[model samples]
Target: MSAERTGVQTRITDVAALAGVSIGTASKALNGTGQLRDSTRQRVKDAAEKLGFVGDARARALSSGRTYTVGMITTDSFGRFTIPVLLGAEDALSAGQMAVLLCDTRDDHVREAHYLRSLAARGVDGVIVTGRSADARLPIDVSMPVVYAFTPSTDEADVSITLDDAAGSALVARHVRSLGRQRIAVVTGPERHRSAVRRADGASSVLGSHLVAPPLFGEWSERWGRQAVDVLARQAPDVDAIVCGSDQIARGVCDRLRESGRSVPGDVAVTGFDDWDVMALASRPPLTTVDLRLEELGRVAGQALLALIDGGMAASASVAPTLVIRESTVGA
Candidate 1:
């Protein structure tokens, strides 16, 4: 008999009976808990769907002593980076039927503290802290499981999911070298910034003696990229390639290079980090750039947070960067 015909509420036991699994296994599969085979979990889920079964949240909460909700705290007011992370996290958490509460502190310490307290009061199972930059920030003092994303926690013991920036820079350096570009230059953001410094160092490690001049440090803007061309003209007039710290800077460099009568790839190849589509696609010849895979990082962070909530240990890890080849480095 169909559950709708009898107007009887379907239970996990009914789902288990239909799926030929024990009630315990059905419960674990539905709740996204316990160790079960993927096929077993999927079969149980299919049975539950066929039976139109839905678990009672109140009873489940009482049994588990968990609210089944998590908090996502971000300091990125612009949502430029946080949005993708949030989307990926949502995807991961949906499998567990867990809810997420988003809190944006806008880089205000006092505001952040308030959100932390609020999340604790709401009885979130855990929290994921993130920011726009890769610079490490102080760890949150919450008693719940905490996972850091993008911007890591200063404490080494905390779980942090970050991008492999140095490796990404090395990829760009190697690609330009493969194109037979001998004289290369680097242009990036502020010297004090960890991301800029790491990227420059990574490229330098690969280019070595082939690097034409010291990396130019300035703001992360097209204006700085345009200005860098002037400096490179004076220092390495015959430079054949430029590795930029960001897509915006690379676009600017391309613009300035065009103005200076240097044909891209034919005369000088260009590469950028952060495959930001708007900047990379709009550039004259497009940009060959590094994909930070921020969404994947977020998904990993979400999984780590979930593991912590489930009494599993999660270690700090980094996602490898992906090099995207475009017309900027290779002529069309």
Candidate 2:
């Protein structure tokens, strides 16, 4: 009655027949290739499931001339940012029945080179390069298609997906301004960091003369955020809002503000970038911040890389940020 019981392998033709589509269409649907409607793809998949059909990896490789695998190289050893990106990529790649090989370079050039050679040797179809920072880096020397996530490729021609840092920072500035916070101060990470510079510039562009003082550049840590409050007291004692470059910094600012008998939102509204749950949600009044949507960025990068692997053109793109409001900016 069934292919398993009859000792016959269930073929794509059987699936096509059951789904009322041509063999080519079925192949395309199963292989995640060609343009097909969602309903059509679902029909074919359902038919395959009913027939207990399993595509053979060896046959697929032979027919497609691909190893059905991709490599992800990340320099973020702690996986703070890279993990979400990797998870999003996996979600996209798994839909096409592709596997991912992770390579952690730990910011070592020698180790990175080794991993590159190793991925090449293993015949990975493509590589996705990512890092904790959003700064651009030199493209990896590879013949196959490559996509950069978070850390963009320096080459304009390469396919890179990165967060829109300036736009995100602008959102924060506008949010604070909308709250009638006239005296605003920005506190962020190192001045040399591209993200910090972009965020500061974006907020400056929006707040303009309302920006009470120049952005305070320091470490991307709670300590810096706490210390910044003291400086703000002396520099802009009447500051009504503090825009932080990171959720960690915002949490620190909230804590310090509370200790100083200042009510969050009532006395000093605060905003942060990177809606990191651990910091954003844990803050005294919760933080109103810009969500970078790193996972979505990774999904886009994966889709772009897949297109490139499928003989599509390469292009660089940016993902817009989302504004997440909380009690920090608006009273609960």
Candidate 3:
């Protein structure tokens, strides 16, 4: 055996040399392809292991003509809602033997465009764009199959899967109404968000002639919830119930209501969207919230990506949101 030299970099050649075989034989043996003696394969594997040799993913993709990476782009606000969606998408991707490349656009077209270009350059097999809502224009030049989860692309060309907020919000409204509260108030994210608007619309359709607190336009933040309720308390003094766009927002609303000397469901009932488990565990009285089925959103998107990769036909998909009742709003 030749002695190792100082400052000499190692390569496949070095593995082949140490294994006493050709570079092609070393590659075949390590990759477990082509016919080779079992002992010979073991020798190549041990040599490569000792050398800490690993193949380049990009190189492998180029050679096979299938980049195993899929692009996932989302908005900054999506963090609260997209956790399960991403989890489901990753699960589906892993099961299908693919990798995910995540990017946050923060609801900016310029940033979204940059990521789209980068993902295309990387030759990703497909792209999944999770929107904060279904009211933004996607740059239409992306070459790979694109799937929109929870947020549909402005162009109808892209496949979309979203929570049926219309149904979910209406259900929440009915629950609030059945409690015999005629005066209702709502604090939601932004009117520009199609999901938020849809939720408001659904709630309105159910709670006719009820005073809806002026729709608060803000990001999905606890502080927004606090501020929204503070304003609502003064504007709609007779308000009997408060509905929040998300659970985090509900926490703020509940806290603000308490600070204002109002007892939850005793003075003013509070309800929220997004059945955030962590919030439910930490809140004083477990929050009554709606489950948007985020993981299912991810699962559907993942399945869609696989279908696209496998040359399957195009089809639209959607999932319904469900309400989870708790102490904050009713049955206290």
Candidate 4:
């Protein structure tokens, strides 16, 4: 080797020599890819670790033309409905042996555009758009494989896995109906939200022939919850069951119903979505809700992106959502 080549400081070649493998093999194994045997991969990893060799991600990306880093663009920061999803996506990506770059736009179109473009510029292998209750109209066309989890973009060409609002809402209605509550009411978010509309449709379908006032529409906030309860009280005093779009709204409904001297399941039953009691799991009277399978959505999104990266075909897929019954909606 030339003097200049001999003076290179990379330990990858050293690690490869120790592992009895080619430098390219060491590179692939350490970078978490290639068709190497399991034992060879482990040996390469161990040797690299022992030699304190960190594979250069950029060089690997350049050689393979694959960045191996996935980006996630969230409309909101981690919240009641989104934390599980973020955690799940993180877990899934980590298991895939890929790095994550997170961007929070807080539902701003301009900021979202900036982040999306920035991620694209960085050469992310794929992107997962997470948890936006509003319509997502990204300004630029993304060149990377894109997956939408817990939220769908306005463009139908993008892949997505969202909570089955119809299924969740129907579950709540069925539970309330099982409790024999003849009068039902709904407190949901803005009418423009696709989720809110689907949940309402699901509830209406399941509560056939029952008396339900027009749904009280508002933001997904505890304040809206409190205000909506008051409005419902005046507008539909005879409501026997109330299904909230979210756990926060349900908490507001429960608090107001209690203050108004209504016994849960006796006078009015309440239910929520996103299994809101992740905070108060130890509480005696916890909330009832729907498990939107947020993390599972992450797993599916990651799998789809990986498949896309592998040049495998993928059809638009759906994940199942489940309901968790708790004291909030059950009888006395």
Candidate 5:
């Protein structure tokens, strides 16, 4: 009602009225919350933009007593996969005009509980929980909003955004198949590893008709890769493609195949997972891999948590893997 509450030329009501939505809807749209349809959200945003309306984050937080800070917990701490996810979450939160507080639990439940309590006491508006892999972990039984990044919660209802390992593996399988290779086989991590099983399931679903041998389960090391290569040669001597569950395994396969008087892509086409550049590029002819899009995963998690904090519906999402082609599969 007062001019002070309304800006000199524009007001929240003006935005809402122009967008054909309620004031509450306008507030949620500007605040980056309230699960409006993309079209609706865009309309609201366009209305605000045309009116030159700017909503101050600090002012909204002060008026609503909202902290505008999101808390993130990671089990793997700064492990290779976790950092990129964390970075993505940070970028997304910052863009939403929020801050993030990170707690590294190192896979300890006690420490995780302590951090959850501490974050709640600090009044974090929401929480993002991530892990090194996509395996489902137990939920953080906090009262506030929570989003799992790159890790699903055992509670099926909880919002989780994860990399589609099955999709990634199938992508590699199809790529190798497209290269005119019929006898495809797999070498991957331990059988107990969920990532390994999921990846195997994915590849097998697509390559069932073309598989020469079953996936060889082993550790996530070059030594295992080397050993598996030898084993597969005997089991399926005519195997023309080896689809590794990881870059490490693929690198090892590449090494052993060459040592055994086989040429990569000439005799066998090798591919791996996780598009981790260090290993992919350093290999003899570089590696063809599936990029899990870890950064994008984290970014989506961050945005989802923020939206839930703003009283929106839970956002559960899955990202498809991107196939990165290189000398190993394409042939230089």
Candidate 6:
């Protein structure tokens, strides 16, 4: 049935009829909710635009009882890694006209609970939960939609975004192998950390027979890296290459190697991860490392969370590690 336009007023039912969809489906498309096909949504939008349909965008949003704000809750807001994710997320969210409310809970469950309740009371459209690592954790129950970034919720139903650490480590392994360096060893963080374990697993699978020995699971500090050097020396004095789990550990390994009169990428090659500029760029010969694309991770995570808030479907995604070559791996 053709929409009966009484004067210049075009009702929502008119747009619905023009789009050949039910009024509810048209409302979902207009309200930016429901899992409507992209084509269907576009059709509704086109019909609305064609008919010069007029409605208060903000009023329609408010009708759904939404505040048009997203809450980003992080355990470590100032952490080297967390900052990039936040920066990226904020950039994307700002572009989409979504205001972000940041809260640093620092892993304190009580503080976290308070933030959640406060954000819910503020009527935030959704929440993006970011943590220091990608390890799976218990699900958080809340009234609003949530997207996990950096840290993933173990619940299969929850959407998450994280770095592909194993794949990245494999890239590092391949780069070392390409340099004709065998006898590779890894010095990483605590064994219980899922990120460390995944990185080791990836490097080992690719290194195969080239691996000199198993990885040394220690702390994520230069001190541990330096201590690990002695252990590696005892285990394999002729170690030709070392793959550190982080730039800090790599720095310790490189410093110790220099003291031992080992030329980086000459007598012993080294590599690190996270592509931290301060550490990687200042090394005697810059450190080769993996760029986790954390900023991109945040942008993508923000986009995903926006989708969830819009009542659209978003799946768990991962960002790949990019190898950044420097003097540590390839001689200057």
In the range 1-332, model 4's lDDT, one tens digit per residue, is 55444434557889999899998998888877879899999998888766666567778789879888998887777665567777777787777767999888887788988998899788888888886453455423687677777766676777776667888888888988887889888888888888788888888888877846877779877678778878987888888888888877787777777777888756778888777555223222466778888778778777777777778865556666787888877753
Instruction: Give candidate 5's whole-model lDDT.
Output: 0.89
Point out the worst 10-residue segment of candidate 6 by lDDT.
Answer: 1-10
Against the true structure, what is every candidate's RMSD? 4.4, 4.6, 6.7, 5.7, 7.2, 7.8
Q: By summed lDDT, which 10 consecutive residues of candidate 1 come out lowest?
A: 1-10
RMSD of 3: 6.7
Candidate 5 C-alpha error for residue 63, in Å:
3.5
In model 1, state the lDDT of residue 178: 92
Q: Which ten residues in a row have the lowest lDDT in candidate 3?
A: 1-10
Better of 2 and 6 by TM-score: 2
Q: Which regions of candidate 4 deviate over 4 angstroms?
A: 1-54, 78-80, 106-110, 134-136, 227-236, 278-285
TM-score for each prediction? 0.88, 0.87, 0.72, 0.79, 0.82, 0.82
Model 4 clash pairs? none
lDDT of 2 by residue, 205-233 (tens): 99999999989999899888899998999
Task: Score each candidate by Cα lDDT.
Answer: 0.92, 0.91, 0.81, 0.77, 0.89, 0.89
| Prediction 5 TM-score vs. true | 0.82
Q: What clash pairs does model 5 have?
A: none
Candidate 5 per-residue lDDT, tens place, 1-332, comes to 56544455688899999999999999888878868888888999999887778777568778778878888899997899999999999999999878888799999989998999999888889899998877788888999999998889988899999888999999999999888899999888988878899999999999997988778899998888899988987799999999999998899999999999999989999998988888899987799999989999888888888788778886688889899999899899
Clashes of 2: 0
> What digit string (tens of lDDT, one per residue) describes model 1 on residues 136-223?
9999999999999999999998999998899999999999999989999999999988999999999999999999999899989999
lDDT of 1: 0.92
Candidate 6 local lDDT, 222-251, one digit each (tens): 898789889998999999999999898999
Q: What does the lDDT read for residue 75 in candidate 1?
A: 97
Worst 10 residues of 5 by lDDT: 1-10
RMSD in angstroms, candidate 1? 4.4
